[model samples]
Target: MESTAGRLTRKTAIISGAGSGIGAATAELFAREGASVVVTDKDGSSAASTAERIREEGGVAEPFTADVSDEAAVIELVAFTAQRFGGIDIVQNYASNRSLVPFDVAIAEADLSVWVQQLSVDLLGCVLTAKHALPHMVRAGSGSIVNVSSLGAWLSFESRPAYTTSKAAVIGLSKSLATEYGKQGIRCNVIAPGHIVSAGTENMYSDEQTEVMLDHVSAPRLGRPDDVALAALFLASPESSFINGQVIVVDGGMSAYAPMVPSFRRLAEAT
Candidate 1:
């Protein structure tokens, strides 16, 4: 077995949306690194399962069920975490309203409700989490907030206006938090992932779409949940103490250059 580094030793972390995918992966990784983790999600069973697995691995973790969109729920979640784990040293705002993707459409065709719902869970959730957690961190005079955004925030998608807009807002939120809290020792950063293979997003791209995506990516494979999880770990750890108000793109260089270059090269090669 490989030895654990204990990068987060003595730190207590609250990871929202940790029932599955990137959130779950990040929760597990944080535990292994020595943080006492509070794994939370709207799905009670899923949250419990992730916590159970962490415990099975001999790491300290507890599961809580709360909808991040609800301000009351978020307030209670933060209190519970602090009471259970002593204090909040780190917070990973990983919960997002991805189910609204189907309803998310172009601005002209977009439903008002869809935009509201998307922002409630994706953008407002992060705000609520930070709002309730910041005081705890401020009291401690040191903390880290890792908010998960999406590459869609930077790249233009065909549709899903609501999703992209909310994600882009999260980046702005993170930067604001870093600026306001830096003197108090709080650091805030973002992880913008691209085409990650995660729960509920496994079949996001069709076979043909996947091939086109691969051609644009610099890496050999699409991103995995662990790929983003590792990035979260870095921001959460003291290793990035000096890093704040930054956006770390976790894509396989997909957004690095012109999107059509890969297809142009392939066409030339075929000719």
Candidate 2:
């Protein structure tokens, strides 16, 4: 086993969607914590970049190209991780896909393909990853699975019916995994992130848009990829051994202060 000076010493983790954004951040964070990381992404080059960076930083890591939505690919991914690291210990199922559809449209007007596409990658992908990885974790007597969900799962602020529905299902699936597999020493939890500035979303945050978002966000600054990464590390490490089947919202207090007073109003009223 490869041990380091950090919390995850001697542990191995499989992170899906590790090509960029929160996935990449989590992979790098896990490595720094003394974990041997298997960085899997649909984009082979992106996955390799993340793994190479980890190695450069004196961590154990490797990249694999796998589509979480595909059962065969998921199975192969789990097998490869177990073979390389001796057994599976952690899995962060974070891969997701969504179609660009205006939120104003009703679900009835939404295209069926969008629903299938989003569900396949976001919901079913998590299931397949757990299904294949659990047996190994079960045999090993302990494991942690952190499924990345979105704040949209619980809030109505966003559109994309398929996207919201799929994300919500993730929380439900994670709870089931935790309840059913708790006896085996395997834990599953959900991480719900809001307004994270990732590679996939940076361009969408215009100055005006950011100002509006800040009005809703109680924190001084917007959320970051590391915020979510650190939360995942906690759930994946021994520090959270007794924590399972819970939803950790990393939104900088956005959800907590929902229906907040408008920023303009706060400014006009002053303190």
Candidate 3:
């Protein structure tokens, strides 16, 4: 089997949301795997730091800052990558924000502000990035897109209506793009990640909740950023040329198992 590190030598990649979390991890990994990486983030400083880290490791990388939801910024980002790296071979759409508002409350009390905010970052951002990058990839006759969605797209979560809806829409959009561009030699795939440990989860999960979450997963721990990054690498590489229009779940088997039930018998015995 060919190692993934050598798989991307002489290729070029563009990754959004490359400041932190999964995006940052994937940017570094892709660079190590022999790609000239373009790391773009809304945060210029963080994106620069990520690019510097890659350079320090003797890898080729450049950083750009942009709000991916903006059309002009998206166009500029695509142009910058193509100009700098010659042509883009891989694109990882990972820019998004999260919400914790309950649906009923949002419907009854809040305006559509919350909904639009989530959609702007999670749904429209992907579309804008993909749209701008498509023409370049089409001209080259080859490209791969790895969209980062959430497991909440499939499983229901309370107080997260906006996030859920946007993620679900992302998968749908990815499939449509794949179908439309398959004959054009472009592949689009979505990855729905579950319970990944990040800033949001660190604040959301209580100690007890964390323990319960681990019990629900086949893996003994919560999902890590690198876990998803590695998956993104596979999807972005030519190694997955035959794989397209698919949504891969990376939730440590949480989606495959039934909810964990606390033992009432044990409770009674303890009492």
Candidate 3 regions with alpha-carbon error over 4 angstroms: 1-3, 99-106, 260-271
Error of 3 at 188 (Å): 0.1
Candidate 2 residue lDDT tens string, 1-271: 2333499989999999998999999999999999999999988999999999999989899999998999999999999999999998999987875324443246878778777878889999999999999999999999999999989897865457787888899999999999999999999999999989888676766889988777678789988889999999999999999999999999998888536456557888996
Q: After superposition, how far is residue 160 of candidate 3 from its true place, in Å?
A: 1.0
> Which runs in model 2 stand beyond 4 Å of their true positions?
1-5, 98-105, 258-260, 263-271
Give lDDT for model 1: 0.92
Question: Clashing residue pairs, candidate 1?
Answer: none
For all predictions, the C-alpha RMSD in Å is 1.4, 2.9, 3.0
Candidate 2 has a TM-score of 0.93
Candidate topping TM-score? 1
Order the candidate numbers by TM-score, best to worst: 1, 2, 3
Per-residue accuracy of model 1 over 126-223 as CA lDDT, tens digit each: 99999999999999999999998999997969988888989999999999999999999999999999888888586667889978778778899988
Model 3 lDDT tens row, 35-78: 99999988899899999999998889999999888899989999
